[model samples]
Target chain A: MPSTYSRTDLYAEVQQFYARQMQLLDGGAFEAYAETFTEDGEFRHTPGREPARTRAGISAELHEFHKRFDDDPVQRRHWFGMMNLEPQDDDTIRATVYALVVTTRPGGKPAIAPSCVVYDVLVWEDGELFNRSRRVEHDQLFGSAAAAS
Target chain B: MPSTYSRTDLYAEVQQFYARQMQLLDGGAFEAYAETFTEDGEFRHTPGREPARTRAGISAELHEFHKRFDDDPVQRRHWFGMMNLEPQDDDTIRATVYALVVTTRPGGKPAIAPSCVVYDVLVWEDGELFNRSRRVEHDQLFGSAAAAS
Candidate 1:
C-alpha cells in the first residue's frame, strides 16, 4: 500500500520513534524498549552474530547483556544523527543513522563507546511506527570498510 | 506570524537543517557552516561567557579553535538526539537537543567529549531556516543542574 503520510511526516515520525526507543533502552526499560519493535523483530548487534529474534527474546537478551553494568552503573545515552530515510513501495522505510553511545559514570567523565552505523527497517502499524529489523555495524570492527563507506 | 508549515514539516526541516549544519562544521567548512546561522547570530559555547557574535566571528572562532587539530588531526562527529522543537509566536522556533561529540584520532579509539544540551533559536528567512542564537550547556560543567533537567 502506498503511504498516506507526506515525506515530512514520515521523517518526523521516524525521528520521534527512535528518540523514544533509545530513551527506553537507556533508561533500562528493556521490556518497554523491546515493545517498540514488531513481535518478530530481528536485532543484529554485529554483522555475523546471531540475532536476538522476537520482542521477548530481545528484552531477555538486553537484560542479560546489561547485567555486567550492575556492579558499576553508568548512564548510557545513545545519540543519533545524519539519518537518511528512504521509503519503499511496501510501506517500509529504511533508515540509516550514525549512532554514538555516551556512557557517564556517577561523578566520572563521560566515555564514548565504539561508533556505529545502524540500519533499520521501520513499518507503520495502526498509526504507530515500529522497527522490523535493525543491524548495527561498528566502525572499529570494520575499520577500512566503514571508513570507505 | 503563524508558521506556514505543519508540525511535522517543521520538525523534519529542523532535523535536516542540523544534519547539514553539523556536517559542514565537522568537515571544516567553517564559512559554509557559519552561513547556516544569521548574519548577526550569537553562539554561546557555554553559559555566561562572551558569545561568538556574528557569522564572521563564528567562522573565525571556529577556525582558530580547530587549529589545534592540525598537528594531530582527529575526526570529530557531533551526534544529536532527543530534539524538541517549539514554534513561537514571533515566527521563530526554539529547539533543544542532546549532543554528544565523538572524536577519533588516526588508528585510535573514539573518545567522547563532555555531553551537552544545545538550545537554539531559529528563524526562517528567504525560505530557509537559520539559527539566530545557540547556547550550549555541558553536563560535566553544570552537573546537578543538567542531571536535574
Candidate 2:
C-alpha cells in the first residue's frame, strides 16, 4: 500500500530525520552514518560516481568506507541548506540537499568545496524514516589551491 | 494592506526564481543577474571572509567584481540546491540556499566551492514576484574537499 502523509506531517518527520543526520555528521560518527540508511539503500555522491548501485552494494561499500573513516581522527561538519522534499507515491521521497562540507587539519584554515546533491530516499519498512535511495549530485568544486587551474 | 502566500505557493515562487537565476548565471550574464534583485537589491557569495550587511553593498561589490572577472574572461557555473524557504510577514521571506559553485578553465578541470547561504529577502512592494529587498545573508562556508577526507 502507498504511504500517505499530509504535506505538513511529512515535513515534520523529515525535519527530525534531517536533524539527526546533522548530529551524526557533527559527531564524526562514521559507522553511525552508514547505519542511517536501510540495508538496501543507495548513496550516490557525484552524479556519475556510483559507490553503491543496490541495497547490498550500499551496505557493503558504506560499511567499509565508514570503518576506514572512523579509524582516522578527522572531525567533519556538514552544513545543510536549500532542501526540497517532494514525497513519492510509495511512502518514499525525492529530495535535494545543498551541503557545505568542511574538514580541517586538526587546526587549520578550512578548504572550501561547494556541492549540490540530490537524494532519492525511502522510509523504513517498519514505517520509520530511513533512506532507501540517495544520489549525491556534485554540481561544482571550489577553493582548492592544488585543484586550482 | 499586506501580501500573503501559502507555504507551498511561496516555495513554488522561489523555485521559479531560482531556475531563472540559474539560467542567467549559465549564460554569463552578470548584468542580468544584478537585475533579478530590486534596484537596491543584494547579491552575496557565502564563505566570503566578510559579511555583507545591506543591498547597496552587495550590488556595488558585485558590479565591480564582475567587471574584473569580465576582463579575465572566465567560465563559471553555479548549482543551487537544498533551499529552505520560510514565509515572513508582508511578503518578505527568509530563505537559505546551498550553492555548489564551479569555475572552469579552457583545458583545466573545474574547481568546486561548497557554500551555505542564508537570505533574508523582502518581496516586491508593488505586490508582485519581482519585488526585492535590500539585503541578502551568507552565513557560512565549507570546503568540499573535506568531503573526501
Candidate 3:
C-alpha cells in the first residue's frame, strides 16, 4: 500500500487491469496483453508450471498457442470472474480470480473452458498498476486431459 | 482477526479445515463432511446457481450426487490447492481454493477433473471453524461438458 493508497480505488484499478489484459488478448494484441505484466512478471497456470516468465516469453507463448487457433475449427474465449483482492505487502496485492474458458464449434453450444484458478499478483509502479505475477492452477492430471486433444 | 489470533496459526488451522473436508468427501463421509459447515451453510457451484443451502441441504445434495458413484466403475478424487485466505471481517475469512476433481477408470490413467474455483467463507464460531458458505465457480457450458458423459 502506498501513502495515497485507497483500498476501493486500488481494487477497482486492479480489476480493470484484468479487463485490459483480456481486451488486448482477445483483440490479437498479444504483445500488448503481455505488457500488462511487469518486466519480471510471472504467469504460471499450475503450481511449478510456468511456461513464460517475462513479456517476451509471454508473447512468444501466446503466439505459439493461439496462432494456430484461426485454422482450428473451434473458437475460444477466456472468462475470468469472482475476483477477490488481498493486500500482500507495501507494493503488491494478490488477486484470485475464477477463469472460465469457453470454446465453441460451428453449430454447437459453447463448451465450458477447462477448470482453472488464476492467482495473480498486481503491483503499483510509479502510480500505475501492472500484473506482477500470475499462477494458474489447472485441474488436470499430467497427460489426462491433453491426451484427448 | 481475533485478539489472540496468530496469522500463522489461523492460516494453518484454516488449511487443515480444507484437508479435513477433502478427506471426508473423498471417503464417502457426506454427512460428516456437511457437518463442517454452519446450520445455514450455502453451497453454490455458480454465483447464481446455488442448488443447496443449509447443512441439511448440503448433506442431501451430496448424498444424491454421490450415491450413484459407488455402483459405477470410475472413482473420483478432489484435489484442492493454491488456498489463499483473506480476512473478511472480525469473525470470518474467505478461503479461495483451486479445485481439480479427477476421475479414473479401473484401467485408465487419472483424468483431469472439471476445473472450478471453490470460494469458501470460513467463520469462527465458538472456537470452531465452520464453512458458512461456498460458491463453486464451474467453468463449463450448460450441457456441453455434461453431454459428453
List, in order, the clash count of every candidate structure: 0, 24, 7
For every candidate, what is the interface RMSD in angstroms? 3.1, 7.0, 9.1
lDDT of 2 by residue, B1-149 (tens): 13444666566556656655655655556566556667656454533335332445644565665676654434555556677766665546776666555555433444664344545474655544542542233323234445545
The candidates, ranked best first by TM-score, are 1, 3, 2
lDDT of 2: 0.57
Q: Write the per-residue lDDT of candidate 1 for residues B32-100, one digit (tens) a residue.
A: 998999999998876567899899999988988788898977899987778867678888988778887
Each model's TM-score, in the order given? 0.61, 0.53, 0.53
Off by over 4 Å in 3: A1-149, B45-50, B142-149
Q: What's the residue-level lDDT of B99 in candidate 1?
A: 86
DockQ of 3: 0.03
Decide which is better by DockQ, 2 or 3. Answer: 2
Specify the highest-TM-score model's number.
Answer: 1
Worst 10-residue lDDT window for candidate 1 chain A reads A1-10
Error of 2 at A59 (Å): 4.3
Docking class of 2: incorrect
Candidate 3 residue lDDT tens string, B103-124 = 7889997764465567888888
Instruction: Report the TM-score of candidate 3, chain A only.
Output: 0.82
